[model samples]
Target: MRMVQKPSSVVLASLKPSTYTNRTPRAGTLPAHRLAGVSKPDAPYSSRRAPRCGLVGRTFSPFTIVLLVILGGVVATAAQEDERATVEPTLARRAATLILARCAVCHTTDLIVQQRLPEDRWTATVEKMVHWGADLTKDEAAVLLQYLTARYHPGAPDHLPSIENELAMTEPLRGQTTATDGPLTGLAARGAGLYAHNCQACHGEGAVGGVGPKLARNTILKNDGVFWETVLHGRGPMPAWGSVLSHQDIADIHAWLATR
Candidate 1:
């Protein structure tokens, strides 16, 4: 029982290595499972995935780059058109100041914009208005006339007939007393357009007075001289048009008002 039992030589030899090789893994080498293309239990293939293919760290194809360029171009062009569409504040302010001070008293901007008169006509019109009690001084009139002539010259295809020319042409008709007696219907019809342009703002769309007294049933209609005087020289808040309107224009407007 005290004697030690020696292992058999075959058993001892079987336990010993033939070449005594030390197999410590080298640094920067994958684990056995990973080297064999097998996922490790602790670190899975799905969790330690290859770098994903996406916009990040990825090169764009030529077609993709072209699409991006075209989209950018479209955005830039739209931005430029938006800029052009807007009106300049300075220009708008200048026009508004002049128009409101001198022209807006008698009529809306619509009336002024609708007429595309020549330089001479615009000058004459502005001068006439000043004479008839417009608040403008000579310098202001010049500025306003310049603006009007520049923005609304008669060179435009849609420019309206000159007031002077229209009046000069209608003078013969005004002299004919029989023109009024034969049938006021025709005269009233023509006067409708003129009334809408000139008198509608104050006398109203139907001559029922907004800023001015009602003209529909006014007794002043019976007296031609008083009616003409009231219109040409203005009454109270009414602006005078003695220089602006011709006798024929006034007569026609009166005829239209009489109908109303």
Candidate 2:
């Protein structure tokens, strides 16, 4: 207790001034990296670890760059496919054929479809056609009215479902009526059915006219069998009705049309 111990230089640093004048070493000094806060490895160690850290700091990760490139290519291909897959929205040309031939003759399709009345109003319209000597069978009348009311009426979209939607509702109706139903004797009646399906567009109820010449004027009366054949086979923009309808169906239709 009586003898006092002298402090070592390492411990006596506190006795030195807090701020001292620069005393630069002549040969070399302790590492400047350590003074700035970095610590060098103790002994022999691989130097590659520091370089790897620098690479990560200096650039985008290679994996991230590759992912961005792949995503960009996928987005480009999707855009191209969308451009090529444009869809159309309108009544199919085939659907218009009958309406154009049969209904447009008396009044414009614009007028006909625009009327947009109830079921009773539609029945009255068909009945009026009957009063005018239009030869439509009961079934033909129903089909014609149904077709018109479905496509043209304001209430149609609600009451009458489209064929596509009907896949869940009812079996799709077929165009193939029994051939035995065909008869030259009943040709006029059969033709009425065909007319509702095919001729209503331009011919109207009695083959009047909107876009084409009227049948009531006997334009059809003067046509020869060959002429009929040519028209049926589509000489031009008229389209080949022969291909769309069966032979017996064609015969019955021809017979009914002749009566009209």
Winner by lDDT: 1
lDDT of 2 at 163: 30
Q: Which ten residues in a row have the lowest lDDT in candidate 1?
A: 13-22
* TM-score against native, each model: 0.34, 0.30
Model 1 misses residue 82 by how many Å?
44
Clashing residue pairs, backbone N/CA/C < 3 A, model 1: none
Tens digit per residue, CA lDDT, model 1, 1-260: 01122212112121112111112122355344433444334436544343331235558743344444445445433433332122232333333455643575676455776775656788788888888877665555655665565445432324433333322333333343212343333367767887776667667878888877788878998987677677665666665555445566667777877887
- TM-score of candidate 1 against the unseen true structure: 0.34
Q: How does candidate 1 score on lDDT? A: 0.52
